[model samples]
Target: MKKILLGFIIMLSTLAYSQNELATSYAEKGRTLVMEKKYQEAVESFDKAIAINPKSALVFHHRGLAKANLKDDSGAILDYNVSIKLDDTDFEVFYNRGVSKYYLKDIESAIKDFDKSISLKSDFANSYLFRGYSYIELQKYSEAVKDLDKGLQLNPKSGSGYINRAIAHIMIGKNKEALDDADKSILYNPDDIRGYNIRGQAKAILEDYKSALEDFTEVINKKPDDAKAFFNRMAVRLNLEDKQGACSDYKMLKNLGEKPNSEMEEYCK
Candidate 1:
């Protein structure tokens, strides 16, 4: 009887080991698919892994990533919540959850998650960067500046970080700081037009009307249908006493189906 009982126990242990191995294989496949950007397929593979091993926190976290990439922020949050419940030790899980919450506009909740993530891993630059973004949404410019500064210090190549910090600086009336950050943003991401637009605004604030007009004109040169550039250039033209150019931009704004500002309409047309 003792021998038979031992054999049965060994059989059960072997079965459990095989099950775990299968689940791990599926989870690895899911991770590979995620890296391939085949998010839907990755989710399906994660589903199989989860069905086999519902206790795996990593699998749940990966599924949450797939869902987040799919733009299912609410669903991703649900998966992240499950992953956290399973094991709350992974800082990445909390950071990703915070990102999903940020996308959903749950700024306060996102900040809490980022705070937790930072507590777990203080050196993570993205946590500070995202926390800065959350603070910006709350219009806490000083707080945003502090967080963004830390993030940029940690990872200086982050173009989005520089641009966001520029916005905060502009809001705080630090036009020179804003201009410097905008320059950094352009240096990091020359293709992004927001940097040029922000630089133009900063120049206008600094009373460099010609330089500002050139920035706006550069944007229009790259993207002819950009109504934002046209509108800004129109204002700068007016500043430069080019009434005909301002009126021309006003017409282009109307052609693009953009609502010209009431004052601009009165001044130009």
Candidate 2:
């Protein structure tokens, strides 16, 4: 009887271990899929993992990421809250939940989460960047610049930090500083089409139509199908009295069915 009981106990232990192993395997696969942008498949894998181990906080965190990628921010936040409940000290959970809250326009709650994340991981540059952006949205540009400066100190290679800092500068009428940061952003990421667009806007503000036109033309070259690029370039060309170029883009806009009104006729004429 003793030996029979011992054998049963070992069998149950092995089964339990097998279930945990399966759950971990599925969770890992789901995380990989999420990173690969195969978010729908990732959710399916996470569901299987959850079926095996419903109480896993890390699995919930990864599944939340997949849900957020699919634009299911509420679902993602629910999972993130569960994960935070299970492990409140997780910096990533706070940061990701903060992002979801920010998108949902819960700016105060998002700031609190970002604060938690930064408290947990002081060197988290991305958290600073996001927090700075939130501050900018709230019109606290000075505070935003402080956070962005810290982010730049922590991550010198971050082109987005430069771009956002440039925006803050522009908001405060620091045209020279804004121009410098915009140039740095382009230097860091030449292929970033938005960088050119923002730089062109800055040049336009400075009344440098020649340089503005060049920058906008580069943006259009990189992204031919971008409607904003065509629209912006047309405005700059109009300023320069480049009627031929402006009319050409108007025709392109017409072919794209972008303009519903007769404004193109008025502009081109």
Candidate 3:
């Protein structure tokens, strides 16, 4: 009887090890699918892994990532919650959860998650960026500036960070500071039209109509169908006393399916 019990115990141990190995294999395959952008397939693979090893935080985290890629932010949050419950030490999981919450428009909760992520990893620049964005959404421009400044300091080449910081500056009526950040954003990523748009807005606010017109025109040159660019250029032309050019731009904006505002209507008329 003792010999039989020993053999059975050995068999169970072997089976458990095999199951763990299988789970690990499935999890690895899920990660590969995620990398390929096959998010749905990756979730399926992760499902199989979870069935084999329900305790695996890594599998849950990868499944959350796959769900996030598919734009199922709530579902991703669920997986992230499970992963966090299993292992709260991973800064990545907290950051990703913050992103998922942001997509769900839960800005306050997202900020908390970002705060947790930053606390875990102080040098994580993206955490600061997202937290700053959440502050912007909350209309806390000063807080946004502080976080964005920290993020930019950590990653000077981040064009998105510069653009967002520029927006914060603009919100606070710091037009010159906004323009400087916009210039840095363009220097880092020339193809990003947002930089030009922000720069144009800043210049217009500063009463530099000619330079504003030039910046808006540059955006229009890159994106001809951009109604906002046309609208901005129209406003800049109005400031420059170019009534005809302003009317023409207003017409182009209308052609692009954007309704002219009341002021635009009066000006164009």
Candidate 4:
């Protein structure tokens, strides 16, 4: 009877280990799918892993990432919540949860998660950058600037970071700093058109109409249907005494399916 009981216990232990090994295999397969950008497949593999090992916090976290990449931010948040409940120590889990929340427009909740992430790992640049974005959405420009400043210091080559910082500067009436950031944004992200638009805005605010007009024209040349660039160019032309060009833009607005604004009507007439 003693020998039989000992054999039973060993069998149970071997079965438990086997289950754990199977769960680990599934989890590894999910990670490989994620690296290949096969998010849907990764989620399926993670689902199997979770079924086999429901207590794994890391598996839940990885599943959350797959869901987020699928653009199912709500689903990602659900997974992240479970992961956090299981183990609240991983800084990356909080940061990714914040990102998912931010995408869902839960700005305040996202900031709290970002704060937690920063407290856990202070040197992570993306945490500050995303928190700055949330602050911008909340209209807290000063807080946005402070966060963006830290993020940029941590990663000076981040073009989107510079772009957002420029916007924050513009909101806070720092035109020169905004222009500098816009320039840096362009240098870093040359294929993007946003920097030209923002730079033109700064130049216009500084009353450098000619330079602003050139930037706006460049934008229009790249994106002919861009309403903001077209309108800006029209306004700048008027300031430059090019009445015909301004009137032409006013007429072209109709072709772009846009109604002329009050300013356009007043100036065009």
Model 3 pairs whose backbones collide:
none
lDDT of each: 0.95, 0.89, 0.95, 0.93
Ordering by lDDT: 1, 3, 4, 2
Q: After superposition, how far is residue 17 of candidate 2 from its true place, in Å?
A: 2.4
TM-score of each prediction? 0.95, 0.83, 0.94, 0.94
Candidate 2 residue pairs that clash: none
Question: For model 2, how does the per-residue alpha-carbon lDDT over 1-269 read when each residue is reduced to its tens digit?
Answer: 99999999999999999999999999999989988999999999999999999898899999999999999999999999999988898999999999998899888888899999999999999899889888887888888899999998999887888888888988988877888888988999888877788888889888898899899889878988877878778888888999999888777776777854486687666
For model 1, residues 1-269, the per-residue Cα lDDT tens digits are: 99999999999999999999999999999999999999999999999999999999999999999999999999999999999999999999999999999999999999999999999999999999999999999999999999999999999999999999999999999999999999999999988888899999999989899999989988888899999999899888888999999999999999999875788778765
Assess candidate 1 and give its lDDT: 0.95
Cα miss at 97, model 2 (Å)?
1.4
Instruction: Give the per-residue lDDT digits (tens) of candidate 4, residues 84-150.
Output: 9999999999999999999999999999999999999999999999999999999999999999999
Clashes of 3: 0
